[model samples]
Target: MSKGPVLLTGSAGFIGFHTARRLLARGETVIGVDNLNSYYDPALKQARLERLQAEPGYIHHTLDLADRPGMTAVFAGHAPRRIVHLGAQAGVRYSLEHPESYVDSNVVGFLTVLEGARAVQAEHLVFASTSSAFGANGALPFSVRQGVAHPMTVYAATKIANEAMAHSYSHLFGFPSTGLRFFTVYGPWGRPDMALFKFTRAILEGRPIDVYGHGEMERDFTYVDDIVDGVIAALDRPAAADPDWDAAMPDPSTSGVAPWRILNLGAGRREQLMRYIAVLEEALGMKAELNLMPVQDGDVARTEADVTETRAALGYAPSTSIEVGVKRFVDWYRDFYGV
Candidate 1:
């Protein structure tokens, strides 16, 4: 049998770009796909893609996930052994303005990926979910076992739907699917739309930064490298059906009949919002003009991921502190933007 390609969708997006760069750095054969939409700045995505092209043994395919037939064609042509589905409409507040964007990209796009996996009979499929799925649970240290039925935004709801969709596919078709619930991932080459990038830019530009919930919030705030480590580890070990799964207990995190599981990829610690902003201030040597406001719709009070299961299953240990991550991010921001 010919060696199957390793496919990575969202190859130009923040997380996907970083993951692709890491894999290529290790002399891995990778086939990357992306639409390169103008959600923030396609120029940034293009720059990342250019960097990837410099790496040897890397192939590129430009396509949108909503293009069902185009997606199928890419899968059939490459026949990847493993798939990373990371492309999606990402943002909590923006989801309100563009609900259909979440539906088309996160929901419909995910279905296309699942279909591709089944068509190629891919051994493993790993995709990105979000901590926002926790919604108003207000629970400290959110675990994989927590109930995620209460999504506050269309984005979170779509991610929750993805987990359920993966479970159904795994159960019915015996797919080895792993869903990673990432919590507040940040670092270099990050999305301009994310909080870190926005806050950093605002602080440096001497503009007012919105401090939602009156600075009364905490987030797991995981670093991007840690998230990638968890994802790569999951790829090494495909999700397997839980033999000890009990129907009486009905665990929401695992499946007894399907080779499917959800893992929380995070730093396993929570920090207050203003504390995170303070780190940015320290790193950038500038202070943010604060616009403290009441909590907006689809906003959560706090998000803390319990990564015990991730550590146990994938040997995942998040070592990047927010202080370190914020510094790294600011350094990259200034260098990339030439500020």
Candidate 2:
């Protein structure tokens, strides 16, 4: 009995490309979708797609998630049993400039996915969330149980809305859905917008790098492979209505009546920004000229993940240290760019 193909959005994006590749390796038919917009460089997205195109089990569509009719057609045509909705206009700082893009892709695009999931009665729906949803909370190692009522940025607000929307769909349609709050995902074939890639490129080019929060910030910095492990595990185990869920003191991580839950997918260890830079410097063997700056709008000083629920539920453990991870990224960057 072959379950239908997995419909994966953002297939050309960094994490999506990795997830799609792993799925293909495990013999899963992956139906990939991505607009390949110029948010960063479309060439990078195209490069990723070229690799996936070589895999026999991979199918791709160049469509935006917000395109409701196109997405509906895909669901009807493919009949996907499971969906990994990873497409969104991603960027904390960019949200400050173009909030509409976040609303269109994250809000409107999410609605189309929920509709498609309902139409197919998807066995499981796993979507990407962000740790930035923990905005305005100075708590260490953020837990899924913490209330996400104060999202400081439009991007975070849109992801938080996706959780609520999925929960309602799960309750009304009797399908299972899981949301994963990823913390600072980075690795080979990484996005240029991320701190890791930017720092590496600047250091290699002998350019000064901007150190936000005056180099005092910290991040959980989960590697791409670890995140993919958590995603596949969560996808395999669908959410269920919590039997012991109490409405009096509702658990933010699970639902009382709905088969819906959220979990943190992170390394569960906080590393200082300076240490991460140092690791990158060691990898490139070049020191970065630092321009210390105040934290930008919609930026949190520090972010840590409490992945206890993730580990207990999915047996998830993130093993990559900054040293190994930075080295891998630098090696890939050099090879890819001929630097």
Candidate 3:
């Protein structure tokens, strides 16, 4: 018997595109869905889609997660046994300017995905969360056990909502679901809004790059390939209800009443913003003009991921160093942009 196709949302996205490519390489059929919204550059999304189209095992759908009917139709038509839900309105700063976008895409759109998963009885639903959910905690190496009720931005709040919504669905329907909280994911084919991409563009253009948090910010920058590996591992290993989970002191990462779990997928090595920029400069063979600036609102000074549980659960280990990842990204950027 043949394996059922995997329904991967955000197929044209940075992570989604790579995940789909990996699955196709492993001989798994992938049904890709994306709105290809103008959040950044639809042209870039189109370019990613064009690459996926070259694969024989890939099928594409131009649909938004907020479209309930469209999402339901996809579930009915595809009958996908597994799902990788990575589509969301993803910028922390952008959430402050346009909170409704986060609601439509992250909150409502997530509900649509859950409904589709429930309808299809998917073997496992692995969805993307963010390290920003650890807002205002001030905890070193943020762990899933820490309280996440204090989200600082609308984006984080929406992702927290996704966790809660998935938990409810998993408990009520007995379907397995895993949430991967990604740190600062960076590498080739990255989003233009991310710091790495923005800084690279500015440095190459000989423009001043804004050094936020007075250049004191730190991030566990996981490469896109490492993230995809963790994501696939989580998808292949369906979550199971914790038999020893106690109600009196419930663990936030796993549930006793549901087949639900959350894990941090990060490189586990915090790199300073200044050092990260230095590596990028080395890659480009140019120095950056830095504009030192205070921390932006709704921004944390540091984010470090505690991936102990992720490692134990999926044997996840991020192997890419920032220096190597930055060089790879610089090479891709130069080739893609003819710079």
Candidate 4:
């Protein structure tokens, strides 16, 4: 028998848009969902949706994940057995300004998703987490094995809640779930709120760009294509209870009681913020008027992900360099915006 359609939330966002395209290319039926909120430019989201609409095996619904009845009806109607729950109000700084938004979308919306998965007894569910969950940790490379008890922002906190909620459902419902903690993902069709897009736009417009942490920050900066690869790989391989999981020495990445796990999806290399800006300048052939300042509230100075488990489990290999990724983004931005 054929597989049911993959219920993919946030299908209009950056990572979601890319993941949808990849899935469609592989001849998989995709049920795309997105609220297309005005958190950022809705035009970008619409533009992405237009592209997906042109492809075969793609179905889209304009709905919010927090709508419990709406999501339940979708599950009952389509009965998707594999779900990629990527929809969430994403942004650390925005979460500070609108903490309630995070609770509604990331927390409440996630509950609806969990309920839907339980209703369908989903074979596997993969959801997006973030590296910011490691806030206040001074570790060089963030690992899923490490304890993430110090999330500095409401956004990260909600993601941690999602992980816990997914684990409980997996344990209770006898389904599998996986959470991917994505590092600073970038590339073409990226969010305007992200550093890369903001810097690129400002440089082209001859506007000053904020240099947080006095340009001393670092980021793993995984490309969007690499992120899609990791997401699909994790989606294909359902999680299973780790036999070696001991109560006395529990591994945070896996659970003995549930078929649930978390993995870090990143490039496994740290690039300084200054170096990143310099690359942007080179790509756009324009120097940015830097407005140096201290790190903003709910901001971390650096982030790197240890992808050892991701590699061993999924054969994940991130081959994009900062230089190449930035160049690709610049090319796409210019073509898309006619800049």
Candidate 5:
């Protein structure tokens, strides 16, 4: 009568770490895997790993996803019943500077994770994708049902590729897979490279923070807790083939024949960049010195998530308001860094 252990990749990362923490707290076993590479700072990653290690139900596996032999061995050894693939070369701007990193981790590494699912016969495989996949769309709220083809950056392109790869795996191998197109996920123990963290850090230290798009950008800033809830819900119920799916007029969100689906996990409403900064300022009690600049390379002007399908399928509704979310995150930052 054992509820199967969930295999969580990128367990050292921000979102992955949060997901693992929540699962462990719920008395669920998580087989956490990560190479612990120096993407931002290995110290931060190591700290995350330490937190997971302290949890009773968490087991650690230090291995790169692209190391097929090592990854395969871990999967075969654990025989994980469920797979949550969150590891990838993140950061849209970073992708331009280091295209190879994106290829190695996002593309090659993703394929290895899929192979592990295939080998272990995981019941449900959920992978993390980005809202950036809807690049150059200029749509109000990015929808899962819409076709995403024009990705501006390599990172987005890779995610789009992942969706295609997962579909093939679902169709040919009969694996039930789900891809979460995450919006701007921010919270405590978050990525140092992310905007919220960067802005808070700079503002606290009295340094000028770069405000991209001349402070004209907006984002559907989904809290980490909300994103984690969506992830677990998606796993609890495996995606099924859309019974009414029409092959002639294919629905891009769900598969016609394969048990595959894509969901937008975000705070349905979008917020302006200035508004987010104001929230952070209030939480920190410090004003930021803005270094207004034109849109940086590989950066988007805005991002809005359409969570209608996600809400319908998994009863997903993100509850954390910006005020509460920002306050909590800043509180954690104060404690984390003793600020």
Candidate 6:
């Protein structure tokens, strides 16, 4: 069966770029959209867009999710079959500084996307959530079934709102929706604010790298390619209302009233912060000057995702080791920055 054109928001962002590229490679048409905001380096975002612009099956739109008229126009014009809504105000710490951006982008903007998806009757609307949504839970491995009412950061709070908003839209509009809670995703063309990117840059520049949580934190850092694969899989397979989903004993991950589901996309392996830095050092052949610090407010000590349901649903298996992934990221950094 021919997969119709995909309307992919955040096509200039890391995972979005990779997903669009993969879809294009598979001969699927993609209508890419991004506001090109200066959340990070806009130049980096532009460079990612440049790559996608080169592809034949791609059409680019410079627009924001909060711009209802703009977003609605795109949907009206393209009428995409599937929508991958990855655009949002990302960054946990930054949310501490600017909380309104999260509200505008993640909350209001997500509502706009949901409305558009409903209007167009999209086959599936797959959107990005975060592992940080597992805030204040003392659990070792976070699962979708766990209650995520206690969000540590405004960014996570916004994502939780997104999940609820999507569910409501699914129930009312009958469009399938899936929310992916991504772990620490890192790889080539990654976000500059992320730990791996910042660490790599500071180490290469002979500067001190901030080791939060006093080097005791751990993350289930999934590779970008693995995440992109899971996202595409979820997009292809629309969510279905679970027959076993009882209202008396509701599953947080599945829906009884609507075709809405949540899944964790992680490598299923937690690596320590110190060990991750070591792998980066090995890749760059340079040891970092670490400035150990207390765990920031809104920071979790550890995060590990239970991907059993993800594996069963999508046949997801993350194949990249930290060593290999870090090496690949370093290679890309050096080549891109001319270092």
Which whole-number lDDT from 0 to 100 does residue 335 have in model 5? 92
lDDT (Cα, 0-100) at 171 in candidate 4: 92
Model 2 lDDT, full chain set: 0.94
Q: Write down the lDDT of every candidate, Cα atoms only.
A: 0.90, 0.94, 0.95, 0.95, 0.91, 0.94
Task: Say which prediction, candidate 1 or candidate 5, comes out ahead on lDDT.
Answer: 5
State candidate 2's TM-score. 0.99
* Model 2 C-alpha lDDT per residue in residues 1-339, reported as the tens digit of each score: 236799999999999999999999999999999999999999999999999999999999999999999999999999997999899999999999899999999999999999999999899999999999999988787999999999999999999999999999999999899999999999999999999999988888889999999999998998999999999999999999999999999999999999999999999999999999999988998888999999999898888999999999999988999899889999999999999
Q: 91-186 in candidate 6: lDDT tens per residue? A: 999999999999999998998899889898878999999999999998878999999999999999999999999999999989999999999999
Instruction: Indicate the worst ten consecutive residues by lDDT in candidate 2.
Output: 1-10
Q: For residues 1-339, what per-residue lDDT tens digits would candidate 5 score against the true structure?
A: 238899999999999999999889889999999999888988989999998999889999998888999888988888896999999888988888899888899899999988988887668899999999998888688888778888999999999999999999988888799999999999999999999899989999999999989999999999999999999999898988999999999999898888999999999998999999999999989889999999987778888898999999999989999999999989998898999
Spell out the clash pairs found in candidate 1. none
- Over 1-339, each residue of candidate 3 has an lDDT whose tens digit, in order, gives 238999999999999999999999999999999999999998989999999999999999999899999999999999997999999998999998999999999999999999999998878999999999999999799999998999999999999999999999999998999999999999999999999999999999989999999999999999999999999999889999999999999999999999999999999979899999999999999999999999999999898999999999999989999999999999999999999
Q: In model 4, how large is the Cα lDDT of residue 174? A: 88
- RMSD of each candidate relative to the true structure: 1.3, 0.8, 0.9, 0.9, 1.1, 0.8
Worst 10 residues of 1 by lDDT: 1-10
Report, for all candidates in order, the number of backbone clashes: 0, 0, 0, 0, 0, 0
lDDT of 5: 0.91
Pick out the ten consecutive residues of candidate 6 with the lowest summed lDDT: 1-10
Error of 2 at 307 (Å): 0.6
Off by over 4 Å in 4: none
